[model samples]
Target: MNTPLNLAALVLALSAALTSAPALAHGEAHAGAQAQEVVKEQKPWGIAGDADQVDRTIEVSMTDQMRFIPDRIEVKLGETIRFVHRNQGRVLHEFVLGTKQDLDEHAAMMVKFPGMEHDEPYMAHVGPGKREEIVWTFNRAGEFDFACLIAGHYQAGMVGKISVSPTN
Candidate 1:
């Protein structure tokens, strides 16, 4: 094959590998370990919940400009909410729930491993014009955070806030 054709094949192979490597790398074993940790204690972010038990559903949009419409959200404590994520942009996006510190750390890791893929109850990875969902229970009464920790997406302002008001 000519040099140009060889380079083209290599580029295509690398692209495919980058896109699917994270899913193939993180499997059931990884989820099992995360689940075990979740049972140990609740993180500051929030906890995953059953979809059928959700108290309400919120529609969120991830746009090409790296922004989440309604960047700030309010929720009641102990309420389970279903997030309908729509990637109405031209690039890949994600909705990940975490605290400021948690998101910062995760974002840094994502920068290091651009191909990393993770499936968490507080997260939804959506392709352009695609939709995804996340069901979570805001059991704690504190402020939390969510972001699209995909490479430079978070830094590009694709972040949101969740205020969990204390219940009576």
Candidate 2:
């Protein structure tokens, strides 16, 4: 017979199944035991860019102080940019691009699930003294955010801004 407890358990099971796969894959990748392919999905800010279409290259630094050097960046809509990430700290850092709300939600998830992992075209997981890159095409004209959502990093203020202006 159907009951409230069963419904609650069903909801909980569904949520865990939907969310845990990516986190599990991320954990494996984080441990350097496997490689996860870049997930391709169109986002409000833009989509995964073709390396051959990159119009510019921007270098960003992730420091131990929870800061991204040159925290603000401006780009023209429709331009493809190759962002090079340099991790200068002794710990691991991430560069995740998304809307402010999306980032805030993800940050909260990170706080609750410290091992949460996600790999996409707009994110880069960089280890200390390591270098990584994200090629993105800013097809939308608006403001977006990039942050390091690793447990206390986001709460400690590890974030940056990207302003995309219309091309016309």
Candidate 3:
């Protein structure tokens, strides 16, 4: 009788342990889920700068063959540029300014979102035959590439360079 009671007690304890193990594991996973929620809540809307205080103006034209007419733009550091970008192409085009690596990364991200576009602080876009404007200030002097993020556009030579020189 004593041995039977001991076995029954041990079996009950083992069953309880098995049941509680999953609950504890689930609790840990729930904490991880809450942490992820917090992280997502803290995510930022990546747009930068206000559109006031434009210093200089520029006119850029895009052609039907996916090309920028002036492949090189010259600017001075700390100068504000008001860009008039026009897309004369049959398809859509974007005038984006960034480093080569930035353009590559942006192009990769752009490929993932069909019909979704990202206009950076220093960039703008105008549909076919339409014109858009953007005013941005170049704080640093560097060689930045301007490219159209539409599919296969950059590869087809829809890219240009902006040379920002030091203010003398």
Give me the candidate number with maximum lDDT: 2
Pairs clashing within candidate 3: none
Per-residue CA lDDT of model 2 for 30-133, tens digit only, reads 33322545556889999988889999999999999999997999999999999999999999898989999999998898888777655567778888998888
Q: Residue 53: error of model 2 in Å? A: 0.8
Q: What is the per-residue lDDT of model 3 for residues 15-113, given as tens digits with 9 covering 90 to 100?
A: 999887544221123222322221211112112223476667788999878889788999887777877787787666678777888878877766675
Q: If scored against the real structure, what TM-score would every candidate get?
A: 0.76, 0.79, 0.66
The TM-score, computed over Cα atoms with residue i paired to residue i, of candidate 3 is: 0.66
List, residue by residue over 1-168, the lDDT tens digit for candidate 1.
499999999999999988874343322222333334333236786688776799999999989888999899999999999999988988878888889998999999988987674556666777778787777888888889989888888898889999999887
Report RMSD for candidate 2. 8.6
| Regions of model 1 farther than 4 Å from truth | 1-41
Q: What TM-score does candidate 2 reach?
A: 0.79
lDDT of the candidates, in the order given = 0.79, 0.85, 0.66
Clashes of each: 0, 0, 0
Q: Any runs in candidate 2 off by more than 4 Å, and if so which? A: 1-37
Ten-residue region with minimum lDDT total, candidate 1: 24-33
